[model samples]
Target: MPTILHRRWLVGGAALLILLALTAGYIFLTTAATAPARARIQAAASMRPFGEVDQEVVNARTLVEDTPESARAWSVLGLAYLQLARETADPTNYGRADEAFQRALDLDAASVDALIGAGTLALARHEFAEALELGTRAMELNPTIPRVYGVIADAQVELGRYEEAVASVQTMVDLRPDLASYSRVAYLREIHGDNQGAIDALELAVSAGGPAAENTEYVRVQLGHLYFATGDLARAEQIYGESLARLPEYIPALDGLARVRAARGEYSEAIELYEQASARIPLPGTIIALGETYEAAGDQGRATDEYQLVEAIQLLFEANGVRSDVELAAFSAAHGDDADRALALARDAHVRLPTIFAADVLAWSLYRTGAIAEAAGVADEALRLGTQNSVMLYHGGVIAAADGDTDTARTRLEAALDLNPRFSPLLADRAAAALAALDN
Candidate 1:
């Protein structure tokens, strides 16, 4: 937990101290920017993965300096800073983005570009209500823009307004049936228990291409994740490999392949890929996966180190005004440590953003803290949409078992294994064991 010890755990000898933040925001291609702004970003950014946005940021800054009075230039700079923040996982970039957007708004209060930029930044920062307001304003300014609907739909989804989110996504798709819209459709379908429908839409996204190579590859990673969720390890591995071939060492692809390897019990390979990914961006999810892989491989010491790093990173993000309460709560519940803390964090998250994910975490945390009846009730709400998420089903099964509902417990547990036998690197075997005990 000391500074020196943290330094020792750095992947590939990099400092790895600051949270290279993972983006939890929805995806947008941003194809509606001004010609100069788009050209500058596309030329400087090119097809080189989203994690490398330094050149794009530099180009945007130069343009801003060249045309200091142009609100569009300032908006582009703001967007560039926002992209840099997302790719680098550095919350400090968010501050720079905020300043640039404010400057743009000051110059032109009706700048849709600035509004969209600021709205997307809010999404990245997990301020769903603020993002919704900004997106709505942008939509009112230009209802025909697909990206505006993307922002609105993303915020609505996080705010637990599923029907509204669906309508927004439909509008986006009707306006522009491209990678961004199709991908959103895929997510909505997946969450609504239509796995095959999700896959079909993702395939459309893959074929539709994207604004950048990374965008296409990100969709591939998502496709791979869908397969991975269904226990189709072979297909998932193949898609991940294809993505890597297109964009070598793409973080999400590496993470996906690592997950496949872990599911297949190839811990060394999984750890190596995860190390590569965490070295580049250090997403909290990837770090946790690496830690869980280490734990699976019988390296408890290293696993503990990774877990400690996650805690440190979460604390750092909090200090920077990014709320990671749900993530932290899930981590605590999974690790079976500090159940009370997990419950409180989950409660806070559910109150702020009542998404199904928040509901699931809250339910799990409640179960961890021994509030079985409340946990069961909340778990039902988590699955109210009939989402086929194995982990949520697993949680429901466990909670039902605790409440002595043998039939429901058996049905839920069976459904979870049917969906994905290896739904979690750390918990899948436990689920099997629990199911076996119930049978006996």
Candidate 2:
């Protein structure tokens, strides 16, 4: 039996010891739980530039799957899957990424990383509404998350909500100030008739070192396009050359260089560059550019050949379940000397797409074959789509002028110039001539 004072001392000492043990144990558990999350964050940050890290990501995914209790682990797994999808462009990878993100959401419904990754995948698939919803949710969950705004910007761009895209990208730049956000914003500026603004934004993008080589190359190519659009062909040529120096196989740079050369009346040089680009990508845009270059060079035979190749590719694409009616109509109308074939292709495309661009092509094909009335009808239908596209407006104006509707022709031609003041010199010259003819 201890004395009263001695027993009080003994009890106080035991309680102090218990408190110290509990504090030490809590610190140890917290650190143990957080170590893996910190490591995963470090790994993800390191793997951003190396797009070909699919195998490493798969291993990370396995680790996360094994750790069912860790929300951060699921985020790591989702990010890995997203990276794999970006590298492979396999939609299945996106599906897997979505599943991983969904698991993360289940674990922690407010996970910002999961929302951003899921939104990004939706954007890549052109599911704009889903992307917007997910991106908005991500921002709501964590307003500080820069990638959430990036997802929103991409979805806005795909939906042709350029103004909203610009605002979202601006917010992303404000937060993280990364090259991707700047590049996208610059492109939107260019589309909105702010050529200098685009150049400034792209300069910032080039200065920002976070963009990978491929992304930097793309930015340079876009810079060249902006310069070309602003009639600074020399600067455009220099930028394209720089891009090519950085990535010799960059097809967009080659195409940009070809356009600049063609503008400078170096048709043969332009034709060579266009040919190289076409050989590399074989895309409809590249093919069309090559044909146009050849046509500028007065080499109708080569131009016809390029257009025929485009038609062949379009047919192959269609056979492979890829609808390319708009491209097919464009190539056929411009290069198919057989009016009947051009009209047939254009009609089929109009029936399929029914958009302003498709309708414009159908109208142009009809006009080429001297069917003014039908062309006018189709062009009018195109105008109802409410897209103030310069090219479409120009086509409609031409059709109306051909049909002796001087008032409508003047209105549309003026609208085209208002929409795109630098709308191709050829089209502008035609518009001017039509207006002069009306006056006379």
RMSD of each: 11.5, 19.2
Cα lDDT listed for each candidate:
0.78, 0.65
Per-residue lDDT of candidate 1, residues 1-440 (tens digit): 32111222111110001122443332212333223222322343343454456777888899998999999999989888876665555555787888899999999988999998888888777777998999999999999888888888888888889889877877787677778777777777778887877777778788887765766777888889999998899999999999999988778889999999898889999999998887766667888999999999999999988887676566545544566656777887787478888888889989988989899999999998889999999999999988988889899999999999989888889989998898777788888988998988
Instruction: Give a tens-digit lDDT track for model 2, residues 1-440.
Output: 43111212111000000000000001111134344323332343343444345666867768886898777787777777655544332334555667777888898888888787777666554445788999999899788877787778766655546567656766676676656666666655544545566677777777774434655666677777777765677788899999889877566788888887776678788788887765534455776777877776678798777666555544434433444455667777866778888899888876654555677889999999999999999998777634555677788988999999989999988877665454452355666676677778
Q: List the residue pairs that clash in candidate 2.
A: none
Best-fitting candidate, scored by lDDT: 1
Give the clashing residue pairs of candidate 1, or none: 20-89, 21-89
Model 2 clash number: 0
Off by over 4 Å in 1: 1-52
Question: TM-score for every candidate vs. truth?
Answer: 0.88, 0.61
Residue 383 of model 1, lDDT score: 91
Give the Å shift of residue 271 in candidate 2. Answer: 1.7
